[model samples]
Target: MTTKLLIGLDGQSSGDRALSFAENLAKLIGTAELLVVYVIEWSPYSFQTPEENAERHKRREEEISTAMERVVTPALARLEAAGIKAQGMVRHGNVADSLDSIAAKQNASQIIVGRSTETGLSKRIFGSSTANLVMGANVPVTVVN
Candidate 1:
């Protein structure tokens, strides 16, 4: 069976570094497939009017569509052009959980994400997604700096 590597991309410089790392690792491992996922942080716990909730589905669809068009597709094309076997996915949810779920579903051998440069109170309170993924992932997790 071919090994799979799942990468979490945030469309940032750190994310680019992570992708570069994953690409090299995939090439090193030989024939491993690459799956790039962009998760738009979203929460469903907000209170809203019935009308607002009624439009939630539509909004979610639009978000996914935009993410696919703006993020995933371009990344996937770049990887493919570099001759890496790759696929992309766009989801709206908690970043760590979404990446972990996708890795599990795809039977990925490893999960890779960029290390956050943010420090201090905010990161300490909210926690970085890479930290959470390392703590929670079932498979091996790699944080690219």
Candidate 2:
């Protein structure tokens, strides 16, 4: 069976670093497949009127479409160009939960993401989803710096 790596992207430099790391890892594993996912932070716990609900739904669709177009598409193309086996997905939900869910459903051997290195913002103090995933994911988790 081929191994799989579930890579979480946040559309930032950290995510880019994670992708680079995954590319190398895919190389090392040889038969590994990279499953790249970008989770758009979304909250459904808001009160809304009929019109508001319609607008929110439309916005959500736009976000998903944009992410697939702007993020997933390019990443898949690059991986494919490098002769790496890969696929990608975009979802709207809590980042950590969504990534873990995808990993479980895809049977990924490991989950990889980039650690936040923003100056002055401690992930421990702010509670990044990367930290949450490390704490809660069922599979092994890797954080690329």
The best candidate by TM-score is: 1
- Give the alpha-carbon lDDT of every model: 0.89, 0.89
The TM-score between candidate 2 and the true structure equals: 0.90
Residue 99 lDDT, candidate 2, scale 0-100: 94
RMSD of each: 1.7, 2.2
Residue-wise C-alpha lDDT for candidate 2, range 53-137, written one tens digit per residue: 8798788888999999988888899899999999999998888899999999999999999995444555557578888899999
Query: Would you list the clashing residue pairs of candidate 1?
Result: none
